[model samples]
Target chain A: MTTAVRVAWLAAALSLTLLLCALSISIGSRSIAVLDVWGFLLRPEETAEAAVVTQLRVPRTLIAVVVGAALAVAGSLMQSLTRNPLADPGILGINAGASLAVVIAVAVTGIASIMFYMWFAFLGAAAAAVGVYLLGSGRRRTATPARLALAGVAITAALTALVQTIILTNQEAFNEFRFWTAGSLEGRGLEITGAAAPFVAAGLLLALLLAPALNALALGEQTGAALGVRVRRTRALTFLAVTLLCGAGTAAVGPIAFVGLGVPFLARAAVGPDQRWSVPLCLLLGPAMLLAADVAGRVVIAPQEVQAGIITALVGAPLFITIVRRRRIEAL
Target chain B: MTAAEMPTHQARLAARRLSVGYDSRKVLDGIAVEIPNNTFSVIVGPNACGKSTLVKALARVLRIQSGEVLLDGSPLSQYTPKEVARRLGMLPQAPHVPDGILVEDLVARGRYPHQGLFRQWSQEDADAVDTALRRARVEQLRDRLLTELSGGQRQRVWIAMALAQMTPLLLLDEPTTFLDISHQVEVLNLCRRLQREGTTVVAVLHDLNLAFRYADHVIVMRSGGIVAQGPPREVISAELIEKVFDLSCRIIEDPETGTPLVIPQNPDTAAKGS
Candidate 1:
């Protein structure tokens, strides 16, 4: 019966996602009809409007969904793995790593392709994850949530400071970063999507597999072990998955903030903390949230789209603060 | 039913000359114990006496430093982690509950060992989870967030999770810690009920009185080694308490159950009496 309920919820969530996606396709700045969006997606060869919709809005909307899901799922994974409700990709320095690496790449080699940025970001994220894991674990038999969060804050602050310094030293690099850091969804082509899709997919898969183990982990290492979970391997895999998801998403979108942090928290409020449900709900709610914000950005000011990232922050910061204030945000 | 009729050689759990510790310090050394089938045994000791450590080692949470734990007489290390989990379940002291986790879902996690990579959810798993929730008496709180439950209620939820594992042997580490007197009795009685239903139960208890009242067998530990082991009346004495706990205590029978109860005499009172 519980499985049935969860399946029903998943089905409902998926349907809602599709509905939101359709609404997103229809409600952009140009206000294309739902029928037109469907026609454009299904049979693009028939009309010019179809071609325009297929070429521009489809990829953009899909990118919003992918980025949203990836970031939120990564955030949720990191939060649970570290047992900290406050944990997110950006707060943990994964995004900082990606952004800094990209800045360095752009500064040194004048490389600006999303592909190059993706690899650079992944490398940086890997380094940061390893660093945090080692520092957080300390001499303890297992890493505690409080230790991991502290380690994340320290490493993230240091990396952010370093990245800021690079931006400060180079005017050209700052000019590029200044625009990208605003977190726009403008002009991100199919190539950016292609570059990020595989990593995001892999992250999604890894997170799904790690969900049950993470559920046990939420009960602490000893209890998790008593339940037969390989806690160390589970934790390592979770960290790796979060790195890939956040790294790839940030590389694609140049650091969309708070979507990762906010969406999963909301998903938890909706579905509860069993990661089997929480993770999948995160995948759905994430993209719905991102696409909703993107659409809001498009229509909130005609012909002048607000960056989806900025919009998410506008919505997310207050909500996150509310959670912190109303509920205890301690590690599970 | 005769002993032979019971799960024969199902010597489901045994520790063989086991030594367990952290870093260079030993916590349990060269101790051999067999958890007899269908018995409720309790490990009782003061704080830091290695009762919990011994249970963790027995459950494979802590690595054995020098010896082996066995299941059905086979080396425990030979069985896969999941295999051991399939037959043995443990409830560690004060598990860190996930925020806003529903009690039902938390209990459902016990089914992880029985689940396969391909089999997501099954009727069998559902039945086991439901049965556990009922047995632990948390069925009414199934939809409630674990955070919303009281301490005893939450503790029961954790036990319910262990029950969901459907294992024959259940180990609990300080399962009654932090509970009020009433709640402590409630939890101990719940363990007794489980044991009566044929689950082999082992618990590390801090309250000697409670252990004496609840356990069929009691193992006392001090400084990483057994101080005494037997039925409570046969083992607990003023001398043993002084030796293990460094306290002068008077041993008396409880007014209700007639179990041995330790009354630590004040040092002043002892001096005055002397």
Candidate 2:
């Protein structure tokens, strides 16, 4: 794609995202009209729906935006860092890291506050990332994608085994683990968004800052180094940004499995290879996609909503397959 | 113009007692050579003779074992990577261009060394990139994806990227490695044209005839050290080609260009006296 076309596509995606975010707030279970939702937002005294708008739907929509953007940007960064189109938060084991941490917190300590679990989730993700980095680096400064991937898989397997073992030993924890691991936005409070917001914001900031260096890195280490990018520093910084974004998103939305992978992949297809524009497009397009999925999930059963994670997986899987069939993988 | 009045064309790039290798296998040992500024220099030797290694060491991609590479008599290692990159640009044998990368964006990356943290796109960068694209004859291809171009066109794009660096010295390792004869001449002509624009270019060439025709200064290497280096008239002799390349060649002049032409004797008939 030409640079001008990419810029235009990104702008269009951004505007569409703004519309979707508003639609998400108004299209909840009670089905408030768009005008009434806007009126409630503008003037609290207008309707009885104001409280539900403020208390439930708005916070839910905000969580969707933040989490979706975080996951998508994180996925884009990971794919570039690993130079693997298949790399994503779920596939590369970051979501598994958060899941293990949340499982231990809920199963072992019976920590009920979602706010507190955010901390453990971030820590667990960081530990998993460091494990992967160290194991992959293993005497080499830069690890190959294949090696990093293997290490992530190995760590994920071990942590997943531990989670299953914990669940087997204590069936009491199974009830809590079942809902969270299945991935939903149900029963999540506003405080959860507040808890995970700072980390995701910080991660987004790091991502934008690292985008230029990451663009240089796409040309491979020798070319990137010759172009004066500090290749090792760039790689390390990209890893940190991916970890923080994916970790915090997982904390917010309970390991929304393929959103991180799928959104960025779609954004790249839309915007082409330059990360400077692609990252921002990923941020906007991610939530637009997730909210659309969320709405689809809400309407799929008429009343009984499928989990947003399940909906994303359902939609994302076919879209991914279509991408694999239609576009050459090398184009990524 | 007097040397003093000239636009600082002399870039004294040299390596002092440079030794470089991987682990215990020393590829180059105690190698020393001074590169003259504002001239087309070619490093030529047989395979594994450390010509490419020397270029890498000079480019600072490979770490020196004992000595230091110096730019303007200051140790090259002492300069920051960006600082070194500001004055010296390098093109490895084959640079990978990601699919769908636009020619303009790839060229814009050359401004990385000069760009500040907060600066995204500046006028200086745009001008440099524009000039580079024009110089490399890739202005039309600037909007085209690299994957869509032919090999010769893509090579020009890579050269445009290095040219966008606006560095005084450019180092290329085997820039013509995978080109046909016509494309090879096209690339060599591009390098010579770059030298005409006041950029000092050093390239590694496997083709001795092309090297002799294009290079103002030629350095022949044998077993990791300089066998001969000077103007091609002095360096591209039959004896040097045989000793350096282990090939029996007769040195003749290109009638039209007055450059040294190497005519290699057929292998079957070579060394009939022996």
TM-score of the first chain of model 1 = 0.92
lDDT tens readout by residue for model 1, A1-332: 25677777778878878887877777766666778677777766666677667777778878888888899899999888888888888888788778878888888888667777788889888888888888889987567778887888899899889888888888775676666767777777788888889999999999999888888878888888888898778978988898889888888887887888887887777777778888998898888888888888888888888988899889988988898999867565
Q: By TM-score, how accurate is candidate 2? A: 0.92
List model 1 lDDT by residue over B3-23, tens digit each. Answer: 223353556787767899888
Which stretches of model 1 miss by more than 4 angstroms?
A1-12, A27-52, B1-10
Docking verdict class for candidate 1: medium
Positional deviation of residue A282's Cα in model 2 after best superposition, in angstroms = 1.3
Whole-model lDDT, candidate 2? 0.82
Instruction: Name every residue pair that clashes in candidate 2.
Output: none
lDDT of 2 at B35: 78
Index of the highest-DockQ prediction: 1
In the range A1-332, model 2's lDDT, one tens digit per residue, is: 56678889888998988888887777877777789888888888535589878777778788888888999999999888877777787877778888888888887688766777788888888888888878877785667777877887888888889878877887875686767777777666788888878888898988988888778778777777777888878887887888788787888778786777787777776776778888999989888877777777778786788888998888778877886798687724
